[model samples]
Target: MRLEQITYFLSVAEHGNITAAAKSLYISQPALSKQITLLEQEVGLPLFERQARGVVLTQAGVQFQKDLQNILKELEHAKKNAVLAGRAQKPLLNIGCFDGSYADDFLPSVYDYLKEAASGQKLVIHKCNFLEGHEYLEKGKIDLWLTLAPSWQDRPGFLKKKIAWRKGALIYSEKLQVGKKENPTWEDFKDETCVLVKKSQNPGMFQHTLDTMELIRLDEGTIEVVENIGTQISYVKLGRGYCFLSENIIHGSKGLRCISLPGERGIEVVAVWSEKNAAVTNLMENYPI
Candidate 1:
């Protein structure tokens, strides 16, 4: 019945295994197991059916989990309102950013809008990988997620709103022979090495590149992975390899030429938030895409 017990139960349910959930919750496995036991005793029903690999929720447990989620969300909302009313402090909006420049193009407008509509609200940004950002959103650690649409899969309760679209193109050094083509198809770069950002940083882009190469039957290209955007840009600039970049991001680069990929569709930038986050939902509805 305690809040900590409910949290432990939810963590175990999420991870499916006591050890993994304990590790995630930063507590001892025995302690987590004890909490679950206490919770089950109080509920007068066995919540999870234990198994060799992990555990599965009983039918009652499934219902309880859903109810707990709603209860926690409401409690969080109440807490925020209470803090705002009691202290007159700025409400915090924690945003998770998958890409370094995720907020560069659209956030200024969002800031302007918030200044007028939500005067006492404060915005905070957390830069992390796509998977980490998604985790934070799920755990109620962040209020909003701003990143490429493909970075995270659509979950049942999360609301995804597309904010912008940018054309895709190959960015290469002007000195490279591959850059000589006015428009290059995948075949043109089949033999060239491709510089790629780390998969963890942007798995969607990495998979898209693989899929594109597979579709064109161009499997001969070398793939080089770098840690970040700066490294990818440096590789392309020095002619070490070429990389794919959005058209909006390619503007004003001095030594690089961006060639449109054949039949390339643009990528979408989206703002995603939980269905329970009323503040973010409101902001998304009013903000221009």
Candidate 2:
């Protein structure tokens, strides 16, 4: 019937003795008995059977006690969750990855460090469009963005950090003989077309390929393919063209050589975050390379 009455009844049911329940509740025996009697009257049923030494629960009392215990546990749990929700503390870190596979090798190490650094912080990486990078961070859709370098460079109100410059190598068949690996040059690739993956298929990978094209300042034309990586490799093996691939990408693949270029050229990778997001900014600064 009432909160106090419910508590008093539970106490007596637990001890099965009015004297013991009253002593535990810091109340007189008569007071505890009167509260139990009122609770039984409100419920229109007897909850306990009087015995010489202690009280025994009635059939209704047994069911009522089980239900009351369950209800009280649920109420306590709800109150705890309500307090947490009111605080508005979201310990989440969402990352917009230009290409998850591009950074897959290093992402785990980064995740390990963040987990060790802030055990409560949750990290999530979602593949995102390279072109819509600014909007992702601006709209708070992502806490941080990992994209090709210079995309966020020169932009005000944003902080940029170079995460990687993947080692670049030329992937081609032995038939071309463009240039020796010992003395690689743009002139070797001159007049030769490069095969690239299409953005429609993999936007992030397409952007990385474009970055490679831009880095070498190749004036040559490009052939775009869709659906799979084999298409690009096939072009090279068939002597159709050469495609620039990151060293890791070309490694362990058959029918092609990963030629190391002479000059310092690579797919520049960077992490972008808004300066206004102090929490994210701090995370980016301390993030392991």
Candidate 3:
């Protein structure tokens, strides 16, 4: 069916009255009715049933409308993106990030690179959590995802590159001498309650450290687990307990003592993108970090 016919059909379906649809479309009711009738003939089925008060979509019309709506949305998105791509001197760059350590380690380099490459193009950086970033990437809404989460081996048609890895340390109040930095152990916290950042699907570098170290004997009954990092840090700052964080995070945070564990691996930073986004990824990769 023609786009006009689809538009007429959708308008009528929305208004539930041919007169109202015709008014909204700036067309006469006869013209609107003629188009709807032609559309029904083309499909060889009645699309709507008229009632005294209004109209309702037939079973076939209901299914057809659902599919048509999806098609229309995709077509509109493609048109918009095409227009944006055509007008740009440089490609539009949309980057999604989770938290601060990434901002500290990789962002400066990525920013400088984009500036040199985008010379005149638009750059959009959205600071969002993992779930939101992943959703945006899957929906073709973003060009790059820089995060501290592990690579997804099962996900297809994506490029995953490791930028850097750094060990993590438990940070506590420097004012308190609860344990020595050289040999900080669980034994040090035998009777003391410690603060922990809540578990998450897309954990940062310090996630594994927290998971491995605390799993053995975490008196879950005693551990104060807060979902927000800001709250976790605040509790640790008050000397209520200590929390795990990447060395990079430690460097950025103030008034905290970073105690390294003897045998733990640091967090890993990765740059991920869809295969279709190679141009943007290459632009990011070749740019100096």
Off by over 4 Å in 3: 1-91, 118-120, 151-154, 175-186, 200-210, 214-221, 284-289
- Write down the RMSD of all candidates, one decimal each: 9.8, 20.5, 10.5
Top TM-score hit: 1
lDDT of 2 by residue, 195-236 (tens): 876666556666666766676677455565644455676777
The candidates, ranked best first by lDDT, are: 1, 2, 3
Candidate that beats the other on TM-score, 1 or 2, i.e. the better one = 1
Residues 26-75, candidate 1: write the lDDT tens digits.
99999999999989999999999999999999999999999999789668
Candidate 1 stretches with Cα past 4 Å from truth are: 1-88, 180-187, 215-217
Report the Cα lDDT for residue 289, model 1: 62
Question: Each model's TM-score, in the order given?
Answer: 0.63, 0.52, 0.58
**Candidate 3: global Cα-lDDT?**
0.71
The TM-score of predicted model 3 comes to 0.58
| Lowest summed lDDT window (length 10), candidate 2 | 219-228
lDDT of each candidate versus the true structure: 0.78, 0.71, 0.71
> How do the residues 1-289 of candidate 3 rate in per-residue lDDT, one tens digit apiece?
8998889999999989999999999999999999999999999999999999879999999998888887796587567667777886666777777754435776777677777776776776767666667877888777888776552332788777776666766667754456434555556655556666555634542356456465545444257777556677778777787766665666655666776655755666677889887676677567443
